[model samples]
Target: MTFEQLSDMIAVVENDTFLEAAETLNISQSTLSKKIIKLERELNVKLFDRSKRKASLTEAGRIFYEEACRLNQDYFEMLTRLKPYQGNRRQRLCIGTLPILTQYNLTARLKLFTEQNTWIDFSFEETEEAQLLVGLRQKKYDYIIARENLFSKLGCVSVPLAEDELMAVLPENHRLCSCSSVKLTDLYDEKFILMNAYTSIHQLCIQILKDAGITPEIVRTGRVESIISGVAVGEGISLLAKSNFRIFQAGQVKVVPLDPPTKLSVVLAKLAGTAQTDAMRIFADYMCNGCEV
Candidate 1:
């Protein structure tokens, strides 16, 4: 029989009566009697003599009770020996985000949160917007930080964090690099080095140019850093988020503000209708309350 059934049998034998045993086990007398009866049926042996004024154990019950007591003691002893192995392990949260994450002070804020809440461990994936969406959809990430416009139609629960601006990046020696700001029309004749078409920045750049009725001559498409590197070597000009400019140490690349200032909204999002753990809920609230980073 089950360990619970065996324990209940032992309780009935040690207690003064069925009523006393039920009280000790915090179960009804009827329920306890039914369990013992079921156990007797399973073993095809009577555990108690109901004919007596007080319930007494049968010969078979005496043997079973002795074995149950020994087994119960061994079970507890095994648990005691294994308790040390179940040490204080922290719960982990997996987060995916765009490569521009460091541009904001989110990492510093996360460090502060982690310091105060030592029970949580964080795992981060800093990749492109396309990969972030894929990881989020596949449930490989607990949460994701990405562009709001790209994920708006995904029907996810999103918390808009901050506004970002688009800027044009050109080689330092390029003729247009000296301008205070550049318009999409001004770059009409220049070869464009763009990030992958699937990225939010790439999509936004193309849309902004189309709205201005300018078709760019795209020379290449790759990751953000690769696009920037290509621009630095005078390969072509590329557009990137304003915050991303500060982190790139390439002095050969000149970052100029976009004319008319195209702005983007960044958001922290999670799939809708999905269950969140206690830590996830707490972290989401913390981010929502002070989400400037």
Candidate 2:
């Protein structure tokens, strides 16, 4: 009911152990347990699944936790808006992105927009795509930049930014490296170390392999940077956006084209059917039309 209880419940979910969560909250285990029991009694729903050694959230608990997070986000935004009314503090826009998106020269590209609109203060968070969507829906961010194909159903207005050319990364000494370029079929039998499935590019690459009637022997999963590191060490091969070649050091890895290459469009998105702030509108216009605000 109270933010304190909601926060404690979230901490329980985060720390995985009730005792650890209690420690994190600087409360005794008995007090933490009492707070949770009171919350469940008020809500009339079981919150945690205690059967497992490590405490985990029940279905209803997950939903409640998300709402609790949204409540906190909205509260902070309200305080931020109120500050400008009380003082000379400037309102700023918050943007979220997948960490690897930074490899695409996003900082330099954003610099132009910042130069023209010096008054528009900006902050950025690098997180996973799913977390970005959750934050976007809760209005934690004015907009987020991510792969275009992943967010169509979030009820957000998406504007395509640029197409990312997909490429295969291989160890410098890999047999596939002998060829000028490799085909998807060529990798059919190879041990694949791929990007985490949370990435749109990962889903696209998986489908590509599936469509070709080729099932890559997946050895592991990781972020783009981690996947690249694995490939460089001959741990396995991976597919990623071409923009990363220059950004990531490739001392022991080789970037090669897929015979039937593919591309994923990066997009900027804002919650649909909502009034856009002046800052948000200017950013949308600049990214989509290249027109000065």
Candidate 3:
């Protein structure tokens, strides 16, 4: 099978809709269908079960699609390595981080590395912890900065950057605002704006509460800003990392440090066996040293 066929199959599996995949590839739906059929015939395996309303990959198809994706990623990395040798002096550093950290001057922090070395180019992505780990393993990102707990099984090296304490965010006039520090016990009955289960921070929060023998009354679940906004509108109070307090405008939300404070450790992670380029080394040093912008 040709790389074109592999790409078409990967697209179909990713979009799960022939028409949508075709649209993304800028090809006609009929052509996309022909490509998939040809690929399946060559492989002697059904790539997708087309009988269903929404196309779904068969078990074998799922495995094949994963390999195809890896092949594509490897091809891109090969091209990237060769491209720089052709006088492309701009070195690219891709970083994946959590949304909360991205909101709190992460770009500005990286600016120090770029400004000092004009030949280096930087790109940043903010995504959930699972996606970040996946990208890290796939070598899509040069490095990642996320909750310290996420890198344990990803076979990456990590360096602790900061410790973020969970704080209770409430309205300025809320009764809880009168307290100097609120404990997990204090929030047991309070309506909480929480993060979704897929987020590492959310899972960490749940484990902390469970360990403390407190079951929170979850009123809503979403991203950090959503939780903070919910608190601002009096929907519910939320527990967030102290580093995230800068995301809210002054006077919009009141952030109270938690009693018996729990902290999420932040770390910078890189692939275990990958050799760091000079630019990568400099960037890592800047982050660890807390280089000023």
Best by lDDT: 1
Residue range 1-293, candidate 3, lDDT tens digits: 77787788888877847899999899999998988888888889998887978878899999999999999878755654465465655677899987755544667677766666665677889887788888988889999988777776768887777777788888877888889998888777778788787877777788888887988778779977677778888898887778775665635678998889887778888989898986687678779887221
lDDT digits (tens) for residues 30-67 of candidate 1: 99999999999999998888898887888999999999
Give per-model CA RMSD: 17.5, 15.8, 15.1
**Runs in model 1 with CA error above 4 Å?**
1-92
Instruction: Report the candidate with higher lDDT, 2 versus 3.
Output: 2
| Per-model TM values vs. the true structure | 0.62, 0.62, 0.62
Model 2 TM-score, 2 decimals: 0.62
Judge candidate 3 against the unseen true structure and give its global Cα lDDT, from 0 to 1: 0.79
By TM-score, how accurate is candidate 3?
Answer: 0.62
Q: Count the backbone clashes (under 3 Å) in each candidate.
A: 0, 0, 0
Worst 10 residues of 2 by lDDT: 80-89
Inter-residue clash pairs, candidate 3:
none
- Which TM-score value belongs to model 1? 0.62
- How accurate locally is residue 206 in candidate 3, as Cα lDDT from 0 to 100? 81
